[model samples]
Target: MRPAPVVLVSGTETVLADRAIRLLRDTLRAEDPTLEVSDLEAGSYAPGELLTLASPSLFAEPRMIRVDGVEKTSDAFLEEALAYLRSPADDTYLVLRHAGGVRGKKLLDAIRGGLGGGVEIVCAELKRDADKLDFVSAEFAAARRRITGGAQRALVAAFSDDLAELAAACQQLLADTDAEITEATVEKYYGGRVETTAFAVADTAIAGRHGEALGLLRHALASGADPVPMVAAFASKVRTMAKVAGARGGGNQIAAQLGLAPWQVDRARRDLQGWTDEGIGRVIEALADTDAQIKGAGRDPVYALERLVGIVASRGEDQHSPQRTG
Candidate 1:
């Protein structure tokens, strides 16, 4: 789709905002290879700068003037930009990038009020796992590339802390291979990261492989993995298992009810195998205690982590299996 005369790329998600800007530039360039691109810093914008860049060139080539740091625009910029909105120049696309602040509320309000006839491309942060998964899916879908649900979840779990890294990983996969992406593919590329290592430990422990779980856990710690998120990895999986325990319905329906993705429901169902509600609850308690210990309750975080691994590896049988009270 062609960009509007005025485009507002607004949000705190830098990666998404950058992508939006790049896509606009590419689309404009495709339409007219003579596209004249220019960058402006709103924070240091001088008087008459916007008009100068937006004015018709001698050859009358199309222009895309990208103004960044609108969230911290100078007073001069604020006045000029709002005035320019009243009568935007022809044959020019004014792209505004605001990273979110009250600094330019007047300009943003004007744009949103239809002053410039601009369309906003919001780049809101993907704060939830479901949102991030959708981002990965969209990235592949845009390129007609196929990625397995498990692979998507793996990529999300591996880079949940950073959306930029996750997007980069998806791009690498897309560029490096034409074959459908799978979990093994993601693991091959990003398995060495501490986040993946933490999940690996959690997966091994949850699968009841006590010895292997310990090995992975120790290896992760030695690799300088933080105990907090490692414990968090266990907490995340066990909690999903707990949510899926005794829940009935298809993956999609159950996932909708639990605010999880369908693949998460399926994975949680598989993880719940050979596990009882009592076992899940027990492991959750272990996770809490371990979390506390690692966060300054206990002197030896390693011992606490080891204890947690054993508890999870045994499906909570490491402790006295608490009987359910009617």
Candidate 2:
């Protein structure tokens, strides 16, 4: 027989992939240390190496081939692997891992196509809010920890939608606390600790509280808010200010652009009503500058962000205007 079709796993749900990989690796390692394990990356591999007998790696030991990648390897590799999976060898086990989405769906489809049977195994991703709850409950049960229903909801609410972070929180709670895992503990550990979202970032910037905005920015950066998303939020606020500055009415356009649908943009415009047209123009320019900074143009992003926030809060661009709004 040949080797098993590489067990193709993929998702943005990396925690799931990681947990599965850990279990498979440990189980195989415990079963046989001398198991010739080969880890192949999708991008780094060619289809020829996946073929048996003709290629090189023919050893006497029970060889397990594991492939991990950010994307599907290729059609050639998949086709070759499927042929191999038709009659997999007893001495070998093949496992493939991917961070799935639209990104690496080819491998998934291949596994589901022809070889999905007694000899083959396919584990698709668990999605939806309900599925996530079930996962959390099952994970705790597997770990022999008990969690209450309210506590579970609290955990999800407080940690946002990040499964990895939620798992970490659960593991930490399990390790640190001995209680039955109550809602109070979830509130204690993960409350007021929610991540900063794009909307919150916009709110901070528009409030013109430079110090708070800078602190929130730093906190967000530390909390895994990527620079691209954050700058996208900044761009949103800049576009709002630009439109509001150009108009005497239609604050709705400004609010819509800022993701503040149904919110009173006029109220916010009133706050910046003292800001001259030139001041708003400079603010827009500053946003562009900071966008470049966050994207790696400037050396110190934090300092650049702080500088930009300070200028916006202080309305420093007013000095450059030939006439003030008053």
Candidate 3:
């Protein structure tokens, strides 16, 4: 619909509204003055405020009423909004934004149920991995940048999973390289995911420090950290534990595979001296789960990592903890 009176755009971040508004504006004649964009989220307006602006002089342009901060408004305020949406003014556009959540779900549903056709622009968050990929493709298309699947995943892996951060990284990389967007270019310019970030994230997770791990994961992901590399790094350490255990009792194939000097392998055996096979097994399993999560098998990468650390670190004692079987 060129002018949808009721638009229900919901998401964690209000990143899409700007473009949605622009797309709606472009539908109008260029010289209209009444084109309005409202930030009604401050609070839904009283019915009286819904009054359309007086018609401009014949030469003046059209008008638009944009309401923002709709979620911030009270229930009564939202209820009053229905009156305006009931009969939206012609020659004007209205846009409403909700940051998304139950705080105002009813009002949103009502808007959609009612004046949905009048909705002009709707852009919600792209939270899922597939949505993120779609965003990357769209961004590349907009830039006329040729990007392949490898290039897309590379961008996703280099940028934090957050859509805005990912989008910003794409923009920055696109600008800096001024070349076709490809995997190699993304890797070359966007691979600096910060020093020891993966290590810190993994360590805190494995230490059973949920709060610390969460903060670290959020910080890292927000800063455009690559989940795949982080998972790989963490997996590498778990494999190390596995190696140490395997080599603990004359089973040195893993040590040899890792290219450890005899002395180094000996040190590893010493470090793993008291760890039982089950202890190491649990840790490896947890690591596998972490890997799966990073690869999109599980939910909430941050939470998954947190649970992994807890399961691994806590299981060391359970290896000896008495069984509860009756």
Candidate lDDT scores, in order, read: 0.84, 0.60, 0.59
Model 3: per-residue lDDT, tens digit, 28-136?
5365545544333335345456563423336555566556556566766576666656665555556665655566666677666665354424466566778778888
- Which residue runs does candidate 2 get wrong by more than 4 Å? 1-6, 10-12, 52-59, 98-110, 113-127, 194-326
Instruction: Put down candidate 1 lDDT per residue, 222-272, tens digits, no spaces.
Output: 878889889888888888888888676544457779998644665676578
List the candidates ranked by lDDT, beginning with the highest: 1, 2, 3
lDDT of 2 by residue, 236-305 (tens): 6666656655554232334556555322343345446556677677777887887898778987666666
Q: For candidate 1, what is the TM-score?
A: 0.62
Model 1: worst 10 consecutive residues (lDDT sum): 317-326
Per the 3 Å backbone cut-off, how many clashing residue pairs does candidate 2 have? 5
Cα-lDDT of candidate 2: 0.60
| Model 3, global lDDT | 0.59
Candidate 1 displacement at residue 74 in angstroms: 0.4
Clashes of each: 0, 5, 31
Could you list the CA RMSD of all candidates, in the order they appear? Answer: 15.0, 14.8, 18.1
